[model samples]
Target: MPDIKCSVTECEYNSDVKCGAPMIQVDHNNVPKSNNSDQTKCDTFRAKG
Candidate 1:
Protein backbone atom coordinates (compact mmCIF):
# COMPACT_ATOMS: atom_id res chain seq x y z
CA MET A 1 0.00 0.00 0.00
CA PRO A 2 1.17 3.52 -0.68
CA ASP A 3 1.85 5.87 2.20
CA ILE A 4 -0.72 8.65 2.30
CA LYS A 5 0.26 11.67 4.35
CA CYS A 6 -2.54 13.79 5.75
CA SER A 7 -2.68 16.84 8.03
CA VAL A 8 -6.39 17.08 8.67
CA THR A 9 -6.57 16.55 12.41
CA GLU A 10 -10.32 16.83 12.35
CA CYS A 11 -10.76 13.85 10.07
CA GLU A 12 -11.82 10.61 11.71
CA TYR A 13 -9.62 8.62 9.35
CA ASN A 14 -6.49 10.52 10.26
CA SER A 15 -4.04 8.96 12.69
CA ASP A 16 -0.52 10.06 13.47
CA VAL A 17 -0.44 12.31 10.42
CA LYS A 18 -1.43 9.36 8.26
CA CYS A 19 -4.63 8.07 6.80
CA GLY A 20 -6.16 5.06 8.55
CA ALA A 21 -8.72 4.34 5.90
CA PRO A 22 -8.45 1.24 3.77
CA MET A 23 -8.61 3.40 0.68
CA ILE A 24 -8.68 7.04 -0.34
CA GLN A 25 -9.97 8.99 -3.32
CA VAL A 26 -8.64 12.23 -4.68
CA ASP A 27 -11.30 14.34 -6.32
CA HIS A 28 -9.75 16.69 -8.82
CA ASN A 29 -12.26 16.23 -11.56
CA ASN A 30 -13.58 19.69 -10.93
CA VAL A 31 -10.25 21.12 -11.93
CA PRO A 32 -8.75 18.77 -14.43
CA LYS A 33 -5.06 19.06 -15.23
CA SER A 34 -4.58 21.33 -12.25
CA ASN A 35 -1.27 21.30 -10.37
CA ASN A 36 -2.48 23.19 -7.33
CA SER A 37 -3.10 21.17 -4.16
CA ASP A 38 -5.74 23.70 -3.09
CA GLN A 39 -7.79 22.84 -6.17
CA THR A 40 -8.08 19.23 -5.10
CA LYS A 41 -9.86 17.61 -2.19
CA CYS A 42 -10.02 14.29 -0.39
CA ASP A 43 -13.43 12.86 -1.01
CA THR A 44 -12.97 10.33 1.76
CA PHE A 45 -12.58 13.00 4.40
CA ARG A 46 -15.03 12.59 7.26
CA ALA A 47 -15.37 15.10 10.04
CA LYS A 48 -14.68 13.67 13.46
CA GLY A 49 -17.31 15.89 15.04
Candidate 2:
Protein backbone atom coordinates (compact mmCIF):
# COMPACT_ATOMS: atom_id res chain seq x y z
CA MET A 1 0.00 0.00 0.00
CA PRO A 2 1.06 3.60 -0.55
CA ASP A 3 2.28 5.55 2.43
CA ILE A 4 -0.25 7.77 4.22
CA LYS A 5 1.52 10.86 5.47
CA CYS A 6 0.21 12.24 8.74
CA SER A 7 0.67 15.84 9.91
CA VAL A 8 0.18 15.05 13.63
CA THR A 9 3.67 15.14 15.12
CA GLU A 10 2.74 13.98 18.63
CA CYS A 11 0.91 10.83 17.53
CA GLU A 12 2.95 7.69 18.13
CA TYR A 13 1.42 6.27 14.94
CA ASN A 14 2.88 9.14 12.95
CA SER A 15 6.29 8.54 11.48
CA ASP A 16 8.19 10.37 8.74
CA VAL A 17 6.02 8.33 6.39
CA LYS A 18 2.54 6.80 6.86
CA CYS A 19 0.25 5.68 9.65
CA GLY A 20 0.90 2.12 10.90
CA ALA A 21 -2.75 1.14 10.67
CA PRO A 22 -4.43 0.21 7.39
CA MET A 23 -6.87 2.92 8.36
CA ILE A 24 -6.81 5.39 11.26
CA GLN A 25 -9.82 6.33 13.36
CA VAL A 26 -9.65 9.48 15.44
CA ASP A 27 -11.94 10.15 18.42
CA HIS A 28 -14.01 13.31 18.36
CA ASN A 29 -12.75 14.49 21.77
CA ASN A 30 -9.14 14.21 20.75
CA VAL A 31 -9.80 15.86 17.41
CA PRO A 32 -12.33 18.62 17.10
CA LYS A 33 -15.69 17.78 15.47
CA SER A 34 -15.96 20.97 13.45
CA ASN A 35 -15.06 22.41 10.08
CA ASN A 36 -12.34 24.67 11.47
CA SER A 37 -8.93 23.14 10.91
CA ASP A 38 -7.25 25.40 13.46
CA GLN A 39 -9.41 23.98 16.29
CA THR A 40 -8.49 20.36 15.61
CA LYS A 41 -6.11 18.42 17.81
CA CYS A 42 -5.52 14.73 18.54
CA ASP A 43 -4.53 13.96 22.12
CA THR A 44 -5.50 10.28 22.07
CA PHE A 45 -3.53 9.14 19.04
CA ARG A 46 -1.37 6.06 19.49
CA ALA A 47 0.78 3.90 17.18
CA LYS A 48 -0.79 0.62 16.14
CA GLY A 49 1.67 -2.18 16.48
Winning model by lDDT: 1
Candidate 1: regions farther than 4 A off:
29-33
Model 2 alpha-carbon miss at residue 19, Å: 1.3
Writing each residue's lDDT as its tens digit, candidate 1 over 1-49 gives 5888899979999999999999988888588776888878999999996
User: Candidate 2, after superposition: displacement of residue 14 in Å?
Assistant: 0.9
Candidate 2 TM-score to native: 0.39
Backbone Cα, N, C clashes tallied per candidate: 0, 0
Model 1, TM vs. native:
0.78
lDDT of 1 at 43: 96
lDDT (Cα, tens digit) per residue for candidate 2, span 3-47: 767776556777775565556554444454656645564544774
The residue-level lDDT of candidate 2 at 32 comes to 40
lDDT of 1 at 4: 87
